[model samples]
Target: MITNDAMTVQDQRTSKIILAIAAITILLATFAGKMPSGMIGALGIMVITGFILNYIGDRTPIINQFFGGGAIVVIFGSAYLFHSSIFPASAEQNVTTFMKSGGFLAFYVASLVTGSIFGMDTQTLKKAALKYIPVILGSAFFACLFTGLVGMLVSKSFYDSVMLIALPIMGGGMGAGAVPLVEIMSGKTGMNAETLMSQMVPALAIGNAIAIVMAGLLNKLGQVAPNLTGNGQLIRGQKAIEEEDQSTAPLNVTTLGVGALLAVTMYFVGTLLSSVIDMHTYALMILSIALIKVSGIMPTALEQAAHSWYKFVVGNLTPALLVGIGVAYTDLNQILAALSPMYFLLVLITVLGAVFGAGLIGWMMGFYPIEAAITGGLCMANMGGTGDVAVLAASKRMELMPFAQISSRIGGAFMLILATMVVQAIA
Candidate 1:
């Protein structure tokens, strides 16, 4: 009685209905941890929850309009579940364990970082890399100036504002930015590193949350005024190059295997380079891949393979990874506890300053403003890998990851340098 198209629609609806029930069941079930079962069950639950929240976000009024859709929903919804005690402690343990011990987060990042760099054109890579450092400096400078101004107005010292709030937000994520910063400030100001970390960590959490929300708002702005963005493109003059990554490689088993190996090996190479350089492994990996990309030495077939694998991972696993981010990284309670009028104002100002600086400078350099703000700005303001994912997902610009990593790693390094200098000068 029905045509093929109608039958397909019906099938899709049925699938959605089943997924909905499964999602609810995950919420209600008492899951146990036993290696494989624990890993599979937790992953399944997260994926289902993420899809449902994403769907709900797409439907919600202000959330959908201002935040773009499910990325924000998945983030906060996961946090809400944890905060509300709807997500069981055992399930949370299982999920987090898998994310870390089982290395899902690392695995996911390796694939994307490897692919994003290799996929870019050599000329584009060379040009973007050459110009991105100055953009980062401007983003950092404005963030510090604005945050310090707010801090002084709120009865906090200019030194405290620059050291605790502005620097850490621009310092990349928690480990690279705040941890090292704690050590630096401890030596400079005679504050206990742990105590300093406790204060600084909250700023990062709050800043990351604001950055995600702002990313969505920026996307909305891009929609209202198309001139401000290259849609998903970072560079204004460059063609979209490829339309939102349509990987038609058939998910060939051999190709995927090669791609996965390539991803892991690149990560390993980064780790090795870390001993020689003081930067994070991911940052090092980025540098190595970028160098290779711009060198024009990698074979065409390999480049295509990396892009194919990137497409596969991005298409298939992005939703699941978002769910992991909700459970593993997004912590609402920490943010809530850290809020004070002065502290909150300082963090907010820092994020806004980053947005303004990066947007203006990048626009001048022939980069799209929205892309610049999100990558060059919010990427600094947010919590590194997970933050980058959340911001990009919110802005609907996942392809700009190469630039975001540059912001986090190089920008983080720059922050460390700035912190040292500020401490020296102030002391």
Candidate 2:
């Protein structure tokens, strides 16, 4: 009984007992309408569901390889749960409120954006930045081209396909990309925003889902064709950015606090600039951070602290965040209702075009093709911020959050301009 094996088994039993009790207590509180709101109830439900789904996804055969592992599972699974009434309506509402109103998604992205940029190797970053925009443009070009051609054959209207389907899917995400697009298009065409949104929503949702899967596939491709990927590095000659700074002192509470402060401050600054700059806050913040990093204004100590905070957030909160994305943003019904064979084909074509297009141009620009495709193409094609997080997570390249954000914000903005010009010309 006192043997090591016996002791280990006993420990396992005790841990299981405690977990079971906790789970039951949470379930009882949830069913009895006693689940607390804010961080307490919301985080518990999200983290637990995320962990369960993540475990299943990682263990499943085909899903583990090509379907983005836990990221996709948690997302789709939570969406289904949210709709199926398996989870209490109150719990679902709590998660949705927390993700949206609580600004958890923004908080997560802010951490990554600041931390990743600060941790980047300046030389590689500089090189990559110069070439990144071209890759994004390339993706948009091919995505539109491919979607338009396919739309002509199937729907008999090239303009409708390109404008309605291709552009919206690649425009960024809901709030920044599709919603604004509906307004702009509605204003120009004298159409209802609701009508435009109807076409755009399914496109955005389906495109995001496909993009997440494609990210996973690209990750597997990277495994098969090792040369095509930087394993999170954007350029070939540069080593992957080190997650932890070697010269920095070991992490402490003070450093984490500093990182949190800096990240929040950067986001706030971006928001402030957005009021005057006419650009997305994420995009503005990114530009500011890059300028600060390049100018050598931020202290090395502060940079390390920001990076540490990013690592901590990525490591701990990614799963929980994915769950929230599922409950708050993804609409299973919309995805299912729009699952027509031709619609699926068009959406798939758009995503493929983005990936291949971005990958090809990225290679020419001296960036790794897969990394470029994921950040530059898939990120653009996803649901915006949440999409960026999901795409990067599925690709196993959270370190490239800076480039991904750029693709979403700047790339999305470019789509709006393109859409406006195209509408004006063809109208």
Give the Cα error of residue 223 in candidate 1, in Å. Answer: 0.6
- In terms of lDDT, model 2 sits at 0.90
Give per-residue CA lDDT, model 1, range 93-116, as digits (tens): 777877767788778888888887
Clashing pairs in 2: none
Best by lDDT: 2
Q: Each candidate's lDDT (Cα)?
A: 0.84, 0.90
Estimate TM-scores for all models: 0.92, 0.94
Tens digits of per-residue lDDT for model 2, 193-281: 88889988999999999999999999999999999988998888786344334246348899999999999999999999999999989
**Candidate 1 residue pairs that clash:** none
